[model samples]
Target: MSKKALYIRHKAQPGKREEVKRIWEKYARAYIEDADGQIAYVYGFDDTDPDAIVAYQFYDGEAGKEDFVKQPWYPDYERETAALLAGPSEFRTITPQWIKGGAA
Candidate 1:
């Protein structure tokens, strides 16, 4: 089973979605290209609500993730984004223990 960390944001306003997307994009790219042991970082918006932004981050291990978050760029971005964000963003770390048969 692989481990993943999910970050969910239920946007408070429609206008700020673009800015949020840009921020996520920047961070996601950095995670994949610069950070060590990061498998992938993907994000998207809710189809129905549109106000929701979700990020799925796959890591080689938990340690890799811990190091990634502690990087200087990450905290700087977080601080700058605090006010631009609507509310508290929800965070979860998940381990994929099982998979149903399916094709995408």
Candidate 2:
């Protein structure tokens, strides 16, 4: 089966860009330490909009993605970051065609 990927775009509330980044950093660390079936996870701010943050998470397969979302930490993450966001996040599910060099 092909890998499953999730793309999330977050617009930070005013003056909350750094806080959002920090929160993501902490979450990523904990996720890496505790979760399984993660192929790759990448996150960064938009070049044109500092307040905009984007994250791409690749999993082993559909089941892997489902397992990740079902983890107990997922809800906690959502709740912790809710107040820092400007609005609802944009999400997309994808199938990776190819990944070239490391993300820049």
Q: For residues 42-87, what per-residue lDDT tens digits would candidate 2 score against the true structure? A: 8888889978989888777787668766766778777778889999
Residue 58: error of model 1 in Å? 1.3
Query: Where is model 1 poorest over a 10-residue stretch in terms of lDDT?
Result: 95-104
lDDT (Cα, 0-100) at 64 in candidate 1: 57
Alpha carbon lDDT at 96, candidate 2 = 69
Report the number of the highest-lDDT candidate.
2
> On residues 1-104, what C-alpha lDDT tens digit does candidate 1 reach at each position?
24555555546456777787677567656566777666666777777776677767766667757786777688766765665677888887777554355211
Error of 1 at 79 (Å): 1.5
* TM-score of each prediction: 0.74, 0.80
C-alpha positional error of residue 12 in candidate 2 after TM-score superposition, expressed in Å: 0.6
Worst 10 residues of 2 by lDDT: 95-104
Residue 67, candidate 2: Cα error in Å is 2.5
